[model samples]
Target: MNYKTTKILWKTFVWIVLIIGTIITLVPLFWMLSTALKSNAEVMQFDMVWWPEDPKWSNFVEAFTTLPFGEWTMNTIFITVFTIIGTLLSCTVVAYGFARFNVRGNKTLFIILLSTMMLPSTVTMIPQFVIFRELDWINTFYPLIVPSFFGNATFIFLLRQFFMTIPTELEDAAKMDGLGTMGILGRIILPMTLPALTTVAIFQFNGAWNDFMGPLIYLSDPDDFTLALGINFFKGENNQVQWNYLMSASVISMLPSLLIFFFGQKYFIQGINLSSGIKG
Candidate 1:
C-alpha cells in the first residue's frame, strides 16, 4: 500500500479498536443502570431488557430508604475528607524533607520507609488492631483517619520524585530574597507541585472511600459504618441477596470517584508529567 493509504488504514483500525473498547467498558455500567431502574418483576424476567421495560426510578430512593445509606454516606465522606487531608499534608512534608534536605541517615530511613511498603498489611494487622484497641480508637473514625497523618511511603516517594525535578535555582533565589525554607516550600514548591498534590489527594480519597475491611474490622457501631459496609447489610440469611439494591448502591458509591476524576483530570495529567520528569 502507498504510505498515505497505509496511515489512513492504521488510523481507522485504531478508531475501531477504541470504539469496541468503549462499548465493552460501558456495557456493564449500562446494564447496572437498567437493572437499577427496573421493577423487581422486570429484573427477574428471563428475557433480558437492555432498557428497563417499566422503569422504577424509585429504586434509587428505595436503595437509600431501605438502609442507613444516608448515614453511611455521610460517615464515608467524613472519613474520606479527613484521610485525604492527612495523607496530602503528611506525604508532602515528608517528600519535601527527603527531596530537599541532607539529614544524617536520611537515605537509610527512607529505605526503611520503602521496606514498610513491602511488608504486607496482613502481617501487621493483628498488631495494629491490638494497638488501636488499647488506645480505644477501634470503633471510632480515628483508626481510619489518624494514621494517614504519619505518611504513606508510596505517596511520599511519588511526591519526592516529582519534587526532585524542581529547579534548585528557584529556591536559591527565594533564599536570596530572605525567604526561609518553610516560606520557599509553602510559596514555591507547594504551588508548583499542585498536580502531584492533587493526584495524591485523589488516590487517598478513593482509598478512604472504598475501604471495607478497615471499617469492618475496626467499627462495631452501625452508626459509624461506611457505604461499603452498608451495602453488605443488604445480604440476608440463607445466602439470599438483594442484587438490584446492591447494584444500585454500588453505582451510587462509584459516583463520587467518577466525579472527582472528571473534574480533576487536568491535575491527574499533570501528575503523570511530574512522575516522568525531574523532581522539583
Candidate 2:
C-alpha cells in the first residue's frame, strides 16, 4: 500500500479495462468476418462457430455476383460523390460567412439555424416527403443528393469553429493584395482548410455510403438502390436468410469506410482537435 504500488495497481486496472473494451468493440467485426467465410450449415449450427473449418473464400465473389452489387455500388458512389461535393460547397461558404461576416442579425440567424438541429428529423420527415413527392423526386437521386447542397448543421458548426481559428490577418493581407472574398477563399482559406474539408468529406462520404433510410424512402427501383438498401434487399430476397452471403456483402460494403478512415485518420483527428479549440 505504498504510493508506487498503488499507482502500479491503478495502471494495471486501466489497462485491463481498455483491453476488455477493445475486445468488445472488435468481437462483432470478427463475428461478421467469420460468418462471411462460413457455409450455411456452419452458420446455422447450434454452437457458436467462432471460425469456419472450411473457409469459403469464394463467398466474397459470390456475394457480388449473386446480387447486382457492382451496379448498387455505382449508384451509391454516384450519390456519395455528389453528396460530398454539395456538402463541401454549401457548408464551407455558410461557415465562412458565419465565422467572418459581421452582418446584422447574423448571430440570431445562426442560433436559429443551430436550433433546427434540436428538432428531430422525424418531426419534419413527413413534410419533407410530401414536398419531394410533389416534385416527383421519388425513385430518383435528387431526394438523397440535393439536400446536401443546402447545408448540414453539425458540419456547418464544425467548419465554422475551424474557420474561426484561422487568423483574420490572413484575410486582411489577402484583401490588401486585391483578393476579394471568393479569391481569398480559393487562394488563402482553402489550402489551409484542407484538414477540415477532408474531415467533412469523409463524414459525408460515410453517411451517404451507409445511408439506408434515404434510399429506402426515395428509391423504388431495385437497380437504383444504394448499397445499404441493396443489402437489405439481399436479406429479404431469400425466404431463409443466407447469413453467409449477407455477411459477405456487408463485409464488402464496409471496406470503403474502413479504408477511408485508415488513410485519413491523421487529418480527421487534427480537424476534430482544431474545431474543438485545441490549437496545434
Number of the top candidate by TM-score?
A: 2
Q: Any runs in candidate 2 off by more than 4 Å, and if so which?
A: 1-4, 236-239
Instruction: Please give each candidate's TM-score.
Output: 0.94, 0.96
- Per-candidate Cα lDDT values, in order, are 0.90, 0.94
Q: What are the RMSDs of all candidates, in order?
A: 2.0, 1.3
Model 2, residue 67: C-alpha shift (Å): 1.2
State candidate 1's TM-score.
0.94
Clashing pairs in 2: none
- For model 2 the TM-score comes to 0.96
Q: What lDDT does model 1 reach?
A: 0.90
Count of backbone clashes, every candidate in sequence? 9, 0
Local lDDT at 130 for model 2: 98
Point out where model 1 deviates above 4 Å.
278-280
The top-ranked prediction according to lDDT is: 2
Per-residue lDDT tens digits for candidate 2, residues 119-172, read: 997898899999999998898999999999999999999999999999999999
